[model samples]
Target chain A: MAQRAVKQERAVRTREALVQAAAEVFGELGFAGASVSKIADRAGLTLGAMYFHFKSKEELAREIVVTQPARVRPEHESEGLQHAIDITLTWAYGLAEDTVLYAGARLVMEQEQFNAPEENSHRQWTDIIACDLRAAQAGREVRRAVDVEAVARLVVNACTGAQMHSSIESGRADLPQRIEEMWRVVLPSVAVPSAVARLEFGQSRGRRV
Target chain B: MAQRAVKQERAVRTREALVQAAAEVFGELGFAGASVSKIADRAGLTLGAMYFHFKSKEELAREIVVTQPARVRPEHESEGLQHAIDITLTWAYGLAEDTVLYAGARLVMEQEQFNAPEENSHRQWTDIIACDLRAAQAGREVRRAVDVEAVARLVVNACTGAQMHSSIESGRADLPQRIEEMWRVVLPSVAVPSAVARLEFGQSRGRRV
Candidate 1:
């Protein structure tokens, strides 16, 4: 029993290291330019070990793209529209420096290169935001006439564009500010007046969350 | 002189054919995946001819990205807010079928692969839209308090995101509709109420333009 536990812990460490290494490689070289051997070398592991952890480069890319939402966990107590805003803010803040997050973002855009049919990070994010908007509508924080799916899609797409421009303009240093601006213009259209007045767009809100 | 004119016409045809072939190859297999030889073959032209027109794939891709704004020429007499809307609507409509337009859009996103520093297609679109917004503000079609740059950036970014999602979800068939939804939510915040009432989002508006 003790031997099995030790082996399992070692496997976990190897998997984490491989993921981090793959993120750096993908971030630097993009999906097509990155090689599995290069990723294994960067991770200080052998080709056999990398194969043991990830079956192929496509699988690793898919894993990174799908795991993007999991990185932006809102630990704060906000819910509904505020919660949705905080989630995006948190994501924008993390995107400035997080290797895994930014690499996943790049992969999500270049995913067609790898020919993975099941990869839909944008849809996943839209659904997550739609859920929050639905909750907000139920609580009356959002307007009755607001289209939840459309607004959710807007949030996802706008954020994607904002980050793309931000990456080019400032290396993502001003991403949080861009997200704030997006919310400022969009909230008035979808949220109740009181909710709009009370919502926060601060970097600190994202950080604290 | 007639012989020289014939030579010039042949040169122009060669350049146009090369550009069209490059767009198709880039559209099919992204930048890194595309090759100069394949492009030359697709165009049914010699390698020497392609080099005479475009020195490299990066140069070709830059031309495509920089000329994206030129593709959305607003031929209509709508001089202010309406002109800006028509430009985007026209672009979204074109993205569905225009190989050059969609390929340019893709290259703009994946441009980091080619190492060109001067590619700022988003900035170009933002500036173009900002120009129209300034004109609209002067005409009292837009609100005095509206930040022209910010709104322009939003329009560019939201359209980028909207087309990306539309491409993924529906192969861009619904991109014009997505752009309309974007304007529907954003116009109330920037345009005067009267202008909002008058502005059109129909496919015919794009077609007419």
Candidate 2:
């Protein structure tokens, strides 16, 4: 039983290494330009070992898409608009520094080549934000005139653009700042006056949240 | 002189065809994926003719980036916030249908591979919008608290993301609507109350501008 457990742990580690290497290659070369051999080499694993885990490049790319967001967990419990803000700010900061997240974003943007499912990270974020906004509306934190769905869509879309712009222009060094600026412009229109006053847009808050 | 004029017109036609074809190829294949021979074939021109106009593929991509924005001209003169809105809306609408502009946007996004200069379309838009916001500030169309440069960067970055999201999800069918929604969220924060009331977010207004 001890030997079996150790073998399983080793398998997990190898799989993780492959995923990390695949992400780096995919992020740099994109889907059409990336190759399995290159990914395996980058991971420092044999091609046979890579195939033992992921069957193809598309599967590797899909794994990155489905799994990257799960890595962003709120550090502390929050409610309503604060929760929504925490998610956005945390994601902005994560996207700037995390290799897997950055590559996942790039893959999601260029997923057209792979003929992947239409439901992607953007939709997931919209749903998540909309749920939070609904809670905020119930709490009277958000303005009554604001449409939860529309605001959620706008936030997700704007963040997507801001992150991409930062990635290209400044290597994502300014993503958090860009996202904060975006919220300053958007929060006034969506949140009630009191909620706007209470909400925090600081980088430290992102880490704590 | 008449014969010379006819020859010049034919040369111009050939150049336009080449640009259009290059845009289509580059938009679909990106910079590294695109080939000069394929571009020439798509243009329905001989390799010799393509070479005469553009010495290399990099030159062709550069031309697309430099020339695409010049096509987005407003129908009539407008100033301040109205002009800013017009440019954003018109660009959103144009991006959905125009082939060259779409290609240009893609090229600008994937320009890292080519080692191109950082001053691409997004920066250009930011500068243009900043100039307009300065005019708007002078005219009292914008609020006093709003930072013209920061807001301009936010607007451009948000639009970039919105257009890219629309392109990936709906083939850019919903870009104009997305831009309108973005303006709804942003305008309230940046524009004076009186200016907000007069701003048009309609699709028809985009065409007029």
Candidate 3:
């Protein structure tokens, strides 16, 4: 039993290494440009070992896309508007530092290359944001006049644009600033006047909890 | 002289056909995947004719990127906040109908594949929005406290995000609707109270003059 446990643990570690290497290659070279041998070499694993972990590059890409939001850490201790802001701020910083999220973002945009039939990430984000906005509305943090669903969708779309622009312009070094600006411009339409004044847009908010 | 004029007109027509064909190919296959021969064949022109108009694929891509904004038709008959709104509405429609703008938009996103360095489109967009906001401010159509540059950047970024999501989700069928939602969310921060009520977000606003 002890030997079996150790073997399973080794398999998990190898899978992780392959995931990280595949992310780096996919992030740099895109899905069509990336190759299995290149990913295995980058992971410092034998082809046989890599094959044992993932059957094909498409599987690896699907894994990355499906599991990416989890890897980016969307859970926040805060709730409502602040929660939504923190989630995006966290995402901006994550996109900057984490290869998995970066590659996942690229794959999400170029999803026509793969055959994953999952719910679109944009709708997923909209649903997440809408949930938070509903919470904010219950708490009186959000304005009654604001359309919760529309505001949520707008936030997701705006964040998508801001992150893309930041990546293209500054390699994402300015993503936090862009997110902060986005909230400032967007909050007036969604949040109550008092709530807007109290909410934070600091870069420190994005640091890992 | 008449014969010479006819030859010049034919040359102009051939160049236009080549540009249109190249845009379609680049839009569909991306810059790296596109071939000069394929572009010529799509245009129903010989390779020698294509070479006469464009020396290389890189040159064609550069031409597309440099000239896309002009092709998209940013010129607006209105002024102030309405003008800014009209410009975006027009763009949303242009992206849907104009192959050049559609391909130009793709090339702009994937520009690392080519080498053409002018001002970044985002900055150029920001400047255009700022100019419009300045005009709006001069007429008291924008709020006094609004930061024109920041708000302009926000609009550009939001539109970028909205257009991308629209493309991914519905093949841009809902782009005008998305842009309308963007304005509803963003206008409160930048436009004066009076101006906000008067703005239009119709899909018909995107139609040609």
Candidate 4:
């Protein structure tokens, strides 16, 4: 029983390593350019070991896309507009430093070519923001006239653009600042005046996810 | 003199056809995946003719990137925020139907891999928008406190993201609607109340670029 437990732990570690390496390769080379051998080599694992964990590159890419949303955790316990802001800021910071999340985003953008789930990540993000907006609306933090779906779509799409531009311009080191600028313009249009005054768009608020 | 004129016209036509074909191939296959032979074939021209016009694939991609901005023309003579809105909407609509424009945009997005000019397209766009915003600010079409640079960046990036998302989801058929939605959220924050009221977000306004 003790040996079995150790073996299970080892298996988990190997899988994690493989996913991390795959993310790096996919993030840098894209789906068409990335290869299994390169991913295995980057992970410091044998091809046989990689095959044991992920059957194919498509499965690995799918895993990255499906599992990305859970990686963005709020920095603290908050509700309404603050919660939404925290998530966006935290995601911006994470996208700068986390290779796995960055690769996952790239895959989501270029998924159509690989036959991976294209809308899963985008839809998940939209749903998360929409839910938070609904909460904000109920609490009177946002304007009564604001369309939650449109606001959510705007925020998500704006952030997506910010990330892509930052990546191209500065390798995403400036993503948080870009996102803050985006919110400054966006928040005023959606959130109520009172809520806007209370919301924070600082770097300190973006805790690691 | 007549013979020389005919030869010059033929040369001009060949160059135009090659650029158009290169745009289609590069737009669909991207820089790395595209081949000169394929571009020539798509243009219905011989390889010798293509070589006469473009020395290499890199030159072709660079030409596409450098010339993209000129393709986005305003639907009519307008100025201030109206002009800005027209450019964005016209660009969105043109991005849907113009293969040359679409390929140019893709090249700009993936310029790093091909050593193409990265900042030219973005900088040109930001400058054009900033100039309009400056005009708007002087005209009181834009709010007094709005940061022109930040707003320009936000607008350019948001449009970039919207175009990318629309391309993946609907082959860019919905890009105009998406940009209109973006402007609906963005203009309220940057433009003066009076300016926002007068801005047109209609498909008919987006003439062919």
**Top TM-score prediction, candidate number:** 1
What interface RMSD does each of the candidate structures achieve? 1.9, 1.8, 2.2, 2.2
Stretches of candidate 4 above 4 Å error? A115-118, B115-120
* Candidate 3, position B194, lDDT: 80
By descending lDDT, how would the candidates be arranged? 1, 4, 2, 3
- The local lDDT score (0 to 100) that residue B199 gets in candidate 3 is 80
The digit string of per-residue lDDT tens for model 2 on B1-209 reads 99999999999999999999999999888888899999999998899999999999888888888776686766647899988888888777777678888898788767665535476677778889999999999999998888898888888877877776777788788888888887788788888898889887677657733
Ranking 2 against 4 by DockQ, winner: 2
True contacts kept of each: 0.53, 0.63, 0.54, 0.53
lDDT of each: 0.85, 0.82, 0.82, 0.83
- Please give the range of 10 consecutive residues that has the lowest summed lDDT in model 2 chain B: B111-120
> What would the TM-score be for candidate 4 when compared with the true structure?
0.93
lDDT score at residue A1, model 2, on the 0-100 scale: 100
lDDT of 3 by residue, A73-175 (tens): 5444788988888888988888877889899877766665674333667777888889999999999998888889888878887777777667777878888
CA displacement after TM-score superposition, residue B115 of candidate 2 (Å): 6.4
Best by lDDT: 1
lDDT of 3 at A99: 86
Top-DockQ structure, candidate number:
2
Per-model TM values vs. the true structure:
0.94, 0.92, 0.93, 0.93
Candidate achieving higher TM-score, 2 or 3: 3
